[model samples]
Target chain A: MAKQDRAIRTRRMILLAAAKVFEERGYQAATISEILAEAGVTKGALYFHFKSKDDLALGVLDEQDSHFVVPDRACKMQEIVDAVMLHAYRLQTNPMVRASVRLAMDQKAADLDRSGPFLRWSNVIQQLLEGAQARGELLSHITPARTADVFVGSFAGIQSMSQTISDYEDLMGRVSDLLRHLLPSVAQPSVIASLHMSGSRGAVVHEEVERLQEHDPSALAVG
Target chain B: MAKQDRAIRTRRMILLAAAKVFEERGYQAATISEILAEAGVTKGALYFHFKSKDDLALGVLDEQDSHFVVPDRACKMQEIVDAVMLHAYRLQTNPMVRASVRLAMDQKAADLDRSGPFLRWSNVIQQLLEGAQARGELLSHITPARTADVFVGSFAGIQSMSQTISDYEDLMGRVSDLLRHLLPSVAQPSVIASLHMSGSRGAVVHEEVERLQEHDPSALAVG
Candidate 1:
């Protein structure tokens, strides 16, 4: 059991190092030697965990959506907002999430399949919108799939712009503005009125999610 | 005059070749030698035109907005829509534009400042939205700057998604969907009813702009 725990720690250390390098140098430019030096792990251990740089990038991408799950809300619109806000908070605070976003948005990484993050995000948002529709939270003209794609794409662009302009210092504010503009178009006025869409909402959601994970440690599993 | 025309043609050839290489390999991985070979230009000619690879990439980036000006409309809302649709059309039909978009969105090109395109786009859109507001075509709560950022970011995201998913074959349809959702929130219902937001708006706008440029060739200057 102790050996297994050490292995897990080593794997995480490697992933975090890889994320740092990938964030700094991008996928194509990042080297395993730099990641190994950063992690201070045996090359054998790194190779044991990830076969190639592509595999390492995939691991980082998977980390973006693995652990952070928002608790359910009565209103699906608010639930979706929480999910988005939580991501904004994480992007501001977490290196892993930032690296994952950089990788996913790196058009230069020709060998890396960058579509997973976008597709997954769109699908998750689509499911929430569909749930909202079942409860009549959406407007009559709202199409869950189309709206999901728009939200995913818009969020990607907003975050990228925020990253470039302010290095995500204003990401929460930009995201709040995004919700303000887009939610009204999709949700009922009453639902939109009740939802919290502040720039500070991310920090609040982050705390709520962290507390929930503490009580149920299994909820924090890193996939 | 003949010598000047030859110089201009040679410069254009280098820029086009640089765009092709940049589009394929991205800014970081692309080399000037490859661009020279692709352009079939002598090393002296390439250096005379562009100081470095960065200069070449910047040249391509500038091309995206240089020749493709959308003609003004009485309704600024339609004009903004035309601007966006025309860009979508160009992204489908133009390689230099694609390369420029790739560079603008390439987060890995740490040496390149990608904010120029986004900021320029937002500013342009904001001006149009402000015009719409002045004409009483906008909703009461719409802030032109804020809404313009949303439109720019959303369009960026939508285009990236379309590129990844379908190589932009369905980009026009996706962009039309984007305007459809966001326009209702910003534009007055009457203005929304009058505007043409179809996927084919791009082709029509492109033809209109092309005809205008042909009549006034100076309007198509490669800035």
Candidate 2:
């Protein structure tokens, strides 16, 4: 068991090092030698875990997937939306998440399967939207899949924007504001009301608003 | 005058060839020798126009910028929105635009002060958003600069998504549908109305709706 744990740790260390190298130098330019040097792993250990550089990249992507855990609670649509916003906020603050974002954007070939991080998040939201729809918590006409695509695509865009603009500190608030505008058009009144009612204590929702009001008043207008 | 005209034409030819080489081989892999070979120009001619490979890449960016002329006439906000959507539609069909999209997203660094295509588009959108705000077309609270970032970033995301999911024929429609959901929230009502009205004749938008109707009825129901 101890030997197994050490192997696992070594594998993770390699993945982290490879992710960093790929993020810095890009997929085509990044070398395995740099990854081994960074991870302090022998070539044999690296080869034991991954067959080739492509396989190593896929392993890095898989490791990335493990880190992006969505909260597994039953909540209203707004709560889910807030969760998504907070995820973006956390991603903005975390260096690993930032590096992953850069990798995701640059590693276009790695996204052959539509089931990447962005799409997985979209699926999670789609499932929630389906639940919302079955409960009549969404507009009868709002298609869960299409709504999911728009939401995920918009969030990806927002995250990219937050990265670009240095002065825009309240990314979560802007995300929340954008969601508020969008939700009214697709969500049922009950869902909207539930979200607003829960807004005070919901750390994801309220914290975003408070942070926005403090840092970026121009982003969130009360009216 | 003839000599100056010849020099300008030769420069344009070199830049066009460089764009192709950069698109095919990417920035680091593409070399001046390959660019000169493709352009059928001598090394002396290539050096006469561009100081280095980086300078040549920048020249390609500058040449692409010349094609992105903002519409001269100002109409309703919807007209502007439709114009933008139509431009996106053209990008869906045009190979040059598609290549440019790949270059902009996968290659360019995110810094605005740098001479990359993404930053150039970001700046142009910033100016347009500011102009819209000054005309009372956009909400007063939203910062033009941040909005520009969101707009440009979202466009990139959507373009990337469209490129991934559908063939070139269907890309514009998917992009248009995504934009329809998005434009309503940020753009004025008149703009929204104009976009929907124009949708009747928009080959790409109508075809997308038809395609959705045929493949997935749920998508049309939402739209």
Best by TM-score: 1
Report the lDDT tens digits of candidate 1 across residue range B5-88: 999999999999998888787777789889989999899999999999988887887887766466767888988988999899
Give all TM-scores, in the order shown. 0.93, 0.75
Best by DockQ: 1
Q: Which regions of candidate 1 fall more than 4 Å away from where they truly are?
A: A216-223, B216-223
DockQ-based CAPRI category assigned to the predicted complex of candidate 2: acceptable
Q: What share of the true interface contacts does each candidate keep?
A: 0.62, 0.27
Compose the digit string of candidate 1's lDDT tens values, residues A92-146.
Answer: 9998898888888877677778889888888888899999999999999888999
Interface RMSD of each: 1.5, 3.4
lDDT of 2 by residue, B1-223 (tens): 6999999989988877877876676666677889999999889988998999878766765543445532232533443454456556656555555555565555324331222555666677667666667777775466766655556666666666655555345555556556666565567776456444343334544366456557766533110
As for model 1, its CA RMSD to the true structure in angstroms is: 2.6
In model 2 chain B, where is the ten-residue run with the lowest total lDDT? B106-115
